[model samples]
Target: MEVYSKKQQIISAINALRHKNQTLGLVPTMGALHRGHLQLVKKALENNNMVVVSIFVNPTQFDNKEDLEKYPRTLEKDVALLKTVNKTNILVYAPTVDDMYDGLTVSQKFDFDGLEFEMEGKFRNGHFDGVGTIVKRFFEIIKPNNAYFGEKDFQQLAIIKKLVEKHNIPVNIVGCKIHREVNGLAMSSRNTRLKPEHKAEAPFIYKTLKTAKQHFGIKSANKVTEWVEKRFAKNDLLQLEYFIIADAKTLKPIKRKSNKKTYRAFIAVYADDIRLIDNIALN
Candidate 1:
């Protein structure tokens, strides 16, 4: 239930835990805690002797300044949610941007082996660079035995796995499941920004994704893409930005069947100004 804002304090705390022979787990988040994020914390608690949840809205990761500014920051509520965990070993490392970047806010370019060139990377230029930079910094600072991330950011998850592999970072990267609302809308901090009507319509995104998953094997990849596109085109509130069926690993768009072990339906939609993303495994 403890919180540390400064780098030295968190470092010292982790050192004390290490001396106690405690294994550390980390959940990196950009505040605005929702049930989805708490699910990640729950997984971390189950595995590690001590868990450090780092909540920092990293500026280097946002390609759009407006998007960065509009991103939610509910630190007080976030801490309250964490406090309800009933676990004393869980602590929050809510550092300031200055503490993270030391006043030099810039993203380092990374070679994600072409994994960064598709979907989110193509749309949000340098987005992966920002993600890589902040994630790498956290790994260096916390030096935890394990780190957890949700599969909602499937592409980001893939790139991070590559990041660890290429850099040989000595930590296990665990990808947790995507949590959703009752109507099937993927839980997100951005969901708070949705207008009432848009909130009602948002569940359709997941509905279509589920229906698309059903069509996946029967229809061709390209045909399934078209079906999902048409479904969104009829909606007035939600706009489909990009929908692609791809090899889950490389993220290369799949126009036809391949020998790859996995394929996934990746999507991004614009619910007016708020952009939401979700993915489903298509086997």
Candidate 2:
């Protein structure tokens, strides 16, 4: 893997690959790599001639200062994992905040309208705008033929697709399946902060989501969310953040459904100070 921190170097390297007729793929990340991230890289490898993964934890995305401070950074280990997978044709772009933002102030913000005001967006506040800005910048810099994102951040994925369409970006956006641990907990960098006991109970989030999916035909969104909330509330250690059943695309609360429609149940919880999120789809 070739590592480049400067913009010109990265662009030059990408140009070289383009000269060779290599189809470029990009996996934009916030650094703390996990199985979920690697899954995206694997998908990119299969579909594109070269893959570039950007690992900048954009400060603009974090609403809470402490949350940003606590967010994990395991660069050495992350590089080791990438190397083990023989992602040799990969470029790891780790840039500073100044390098990313520079003199270009965040004057204009991209909003996914209702999509940004629902579920995670409602809780985080302005999170998607930060996400949209960074992703837009990455797309401009990388200029990949294709870009990959995991479905774990389903709402983010949806908003990014909208951004690409609204702005007329030329890259093909691909969504990969959410990668999870053997016990069903969605793999996340935040999971590292959980206490041992909390980690064991964490799988229940996914379990509940799966259960909700099974009962989507019988239960209303309100009932499903209430039940899940009650279950999480039972554990004093777990502070429920948000539990929602909404349209997978718009991320808006779903009403009565019809055939062939897809709904997703998303949950965010605080196991002590560590916040974790997971979602499951009902088709």
TM-scores of all candidate predictions against the true structure: 0.98, 0.96
The lowest-lDDT stretch of 10 consecutive residues in candidate 2 is 103-112
Q: What is the C-alpha RMSD of each candidate to the true structure, in Å?
A: 1.0, 1.4
Any idea what lDDT model 1 has?
0.92
Error of 1 at 95 (Å): 1.0
lDDT of 1 at 33: 93
Q: Each model's number of backbone clashes? A: 0, 0
TM-score of 1: 0.98
Number of the top candidate by TM-score? Answer: 1
Worst 10 residues of 1 by lDDT: 253-262
lDDT of 2: 0.85
Model 2 CA deviation exceeding 4 Å by range: 103-107
